[model samples]
Target: MRVDLFDFDLPADRIALRPASPRDSARMLVVRPDGLADRTMLDLADALRPGDCLVFNDTRVIPAQLEGRRGDAKIGATLHKREGPRDWRAFIRNAKRLRDGDSVDFGAGVSAIASDRGEDGSWRLSFDGDEPVELLLERAGRMPLPPYLAGKRPTDARDAEDYQTMFARKAGAVAAPTASLHFTPRLMERLAAAGIGHETLTLHVGAGTFLPVKADDTDDHRMHAEWGRIDAATAERLNAVKARGGRLIAAGTTSLRLLESAARADGTIAPFEGDTAIFITPGYRFRAIDGLVTNFHLPKSTLFMLVSALMGLETMQAVYAHAIAAQYRFYSYGDGSLLLPA
Candidate 1:
């Protein structure tokens, strides 16, 4: 199918510039077979049923944005995928101008020598560091802001909080599992009181989630691989929930993708730890999840396609139109939606 079928228009104003105060106060759009309803994150407890398994991605977003000059090229950098501790695939702002053997100097103690450039203008930039990637990135990197935030740069204030989910523990993602951002500790307690069960897995979301679907034919698009892991204990908990016949609801597309990737043919799950390039588009059969709690995504982006994959193309289009008309915030730090597969 043509990827253009998934495209929609979003006003610049609809892109959320800041997170909702108190986080959980953000608007919620619940989608059922009938239609969509506007609500708030406080309604989550009521929306979820008892024994429903809510899978969460606990991968924390890092301060991956780096500003440095490579020769005369003023390039903005985001460490997208890590090939090794020192080798990274970065998306440079002005990638067309740079070629191999060009040196991109990061701030003090950190400099990247460009080794090669890949298709789609991504560069294989090697860092000049002996320390681990986490340490190097933390020292010189800025918070990797979403593209929607114009003229806004990360500071020490927003740096600590802006791109993080409440339940983050593991670190690797360049993007936050944004749906988790709407949750607060109090809200989680309420969910527990309501008997809505939840579990977490780590899918260090790469920059790939933000990539637009350039493929006219959806099948032609090759997905970027990201690292993920599920331990034995989490697997046991998930299995127990499924054995009780509870509906599996994913917190975001990251958790949903990992769940689908870990699912066995017999409808069972196992401990999974590795990389996955699992790209879910429309018409794909889902094995593990029945519902999704997510945020509105950018038009023509992979996230929109993922949501459309869970629901239907027509349903997502209508739902998104409603969101746009209602002035619901979109993208990271945006309002959320709950969708069940149709």
Candidate 2:
């Protein structure tokens, strides 16, 4: 399909710079086959059946954005994937100034050597210290905010807490699973009280999520891989939910992709651990999830394509048109949508 088919006009003012106070106060646009309705995140539990399970991504966002210098050239790095304990694959901002074996000083005693550039143009950066790389990042790195927000303003101390979800535990992701950002402990308690159970999986969201689709056609676009994990116990529980006629609702595209990747042809989810580069487009069959709760996505983005696949392209196009006209916030720090297909 033509990538241009997914394009839509979004006013710049609609981009949210900060989250709604109390998180759950954010508005949610419910998109069902029948019609669209407006609701707050606090009303999420009421939007779904009691037997449904909301799947969340537990991958914690690391401080992966770094600024450094090699000789006189300024360089910026956003670590996307972990290659080893001390090695990470990062997208560089000043590639032409650096080469294989060139060392970059990220300041605050953190430095790394660049090597083995990938076809995507990202470089492998091996940290110099024997100390854990996490510690190095703590001293030198900033939260990797989505470019849409970061380009408008600067990342600050507030982002250290706002960018992460309450379920964050396993630290690896360069980006937060923003859909879960609307969830608060109060919301969790409310959901449990409503008998809407929840579970967690991990998908270390990379900076690739922010990359634009420059391809003219959907077939020409390539998705960068992100590491994810689903253990046996979680898989078994998820399968049991399906068996009992319960719906599995993914709280984010990260969770949705991992669930679909782990789904067998027969639609049972299996234990999985590794990288998934699943590029969900229109005409793709969804086996694992019944619905999705996700943020408003960029025009012509893979995320938009995934949502279009979930609920036909025409439906989502109308949904976005409604969202835009309604003045709903957009992007990572933006409002959300609850999409339930017929």
Candidate 3:
């Protein structure tokens, strides 16, 4: 399908620069088969049935954005994927200034040698240190905010906490699973009292998520690989939920993509570990998840395409129209939507 088909006009002011206070206070648009309803994140329990399970991504965002210099030349890098204990593949801001085998020095005693530029133009960088790379990042890296937000303002200490979800534990992701940012302890308590179960998996969301789709057609767009994991126990429990006639609702696109990657043709989810570059588009049949709770996405983005595939293209277009007119926020720090197709 033509990528232009997914384009929509969004007022600049509609983009959220910061998240709603008290997390759960953020508005949620419930997209049902028949119509749309405006609600809050707190109403999630009421929107879902007791037998439904909400799948969440627990991958923690790392301070992956780095500003450094090589021989007085300024350079910026955003680490996307871990190639080894000390090696990471990163997208460079001033890539033309550096070359393979060139060493870039990041302040605070952190530095790396660039090598093996990929077909996508990202370079493989191997850090120079005996200490764990995580520690090195702590001293020199900044949170990798989405380019849309970063372009508007600078990242600050508030974003350190705001960008992370309460479920964050296993660290690796460069980008936060923004939809999960709306969850809070109080919300979880309410969900439990309502008998709505929740489970977690890991998908280290990469900086690639912020990349724009420059392709004229959906078929030409390529998705970047991100690491994810699903344990056997979790898989068994998820399968049981389906067997007992319960719906599996993904908390974000990250969780949905990982679930779909692990799903068998028969719709059974199995244990999985490794990278997934799954590109969901319209006409694709979903097997693992029954519904999705996700943030508003960019125009002509792969995420919009994924949602369009989940619901119909026309349905999603209508959904966005309602969201925009209603003044719901947009992008990573924006409001969310609960998509339940009939």
Candidate 4:
């Protein structure tokens, strides 16, 4: 399909600069088969039946945004994927100024050598110290906020906590699974009381998630690979949820993509690990997840295409039109939508 089909005009003011205070207070646009309804994140537990499970991504956002200099040239890097313990693949802001085997100093004693440029224009950055790379980032890096938000304002101390979700544990993701940001301890307690169980998997969401679809057609777009994991125990439990007639709703596209990547043609999921470059578009059939809870996405973005697939193109188009008309926030720090297909 032409990428233009997904295009929609969004007002600049609709972008959310900060998350809603008391996270669960954020509004949620529920898109069911029957119609749309405006609700708060707190109403999530009551939105579904008791046996339904909301799958969450446990991957933590790393402080991967770095600004440094190589000689007299200024450079910026956003580490998107881990290649090794000390090596990461990063998108460079000043690509023309960098080359293979040149060390870039990122300040606070952190430095890396740039090498092996990828077709996508990202470079491999191997840290210079014997100390863990995570430590190096702690001294020199800032949270990798989505470009849409960062372009409007600078990242600050508040983002160190706000960009991370409560379920975050395994640290590697450059981007937070923002839909999960709306969840809070109080919300979890309510979900438990309502018998709406939740489970977790890890998908190290990369910066490519924010990349624009410059392609004229969906087939021309390339999705960047992101590491994810689903152990046998978790897979078994998720399968059991489906076997018992319980719905498995993904809390974010990260979770949903990982689930779809692990699902077999028979609709059962298997233990999975490593990278997934799954590009979900319209006409794709979903096998693992029954519903999705995700943030409002960018125009002509792969995420919007995925939602269009989950529901229908027309349905999601209507959904976004309604979301925009209702003044729901947009993008990573924005409000969320619950999509349940017929």
Candidate numbers sorted by lDDT from highest down: 2, 3, 4, 1
lDDT of every predicted structure (CA atoms)? 0.85, 0.96, 0.95, 0.95
Q: Highest lDDT among the candidates is held by which one?
A: 2
Model 4: residues with Cα > 4 Å off, grouped in runs: none
Q: Give the Å error, residue 256, model 1.
A: 0.7
Better of 1 and 4 by TM-score: 4
| Candidate 1 C-alpha error for residue 14, in Å | 1.1
lDDT of 2: 0.96
Task: Estimate, for each residue in 1-342, the C-alpha lDDT of model 4 and write its tens digit.
Answer: 999999999999999999999999999999998999999999998898889999999999999999999999999999999999899999999889998999999999999999999999999999997999999999999999998899999999999999999999999999999999999999999998998899999999999998999999999999999999999999999999989999999999999999999999999999999999999998898989999999999999999999999999999888889988999999988999899998
Q: Per-residue CA lDDT of candidate 3, range 1-342, in tens?
A: 999999999999999999999899999999999888899999999999998999999999999999999887899999999999999999998999998899999999999999999999999999997999999999999999998899899999999999999999999999999999999999999999998999999999998898999999999999999999999999999999999999999999999999999999999999999999999999898999999999999999999999999999999999999899999999999999999988
144-260 per-residue lDDT for model 1 (tens digits): 766666345445567468679988998778888999999999888899999998888999998877776777888899889999999999988888888998888999989999999
Q: What 10-residue stretch in candidate 2 is worst by lDDT? A: 43-52
Model 2 CA deviation exceeding 4 Å by range: none
Tens-place lDDT digits, model 2, residues 269-337: 999999999999999999999999999998999999999999999999999999999999999999999
Greater-lDDT candidate between 2 and 4? 2
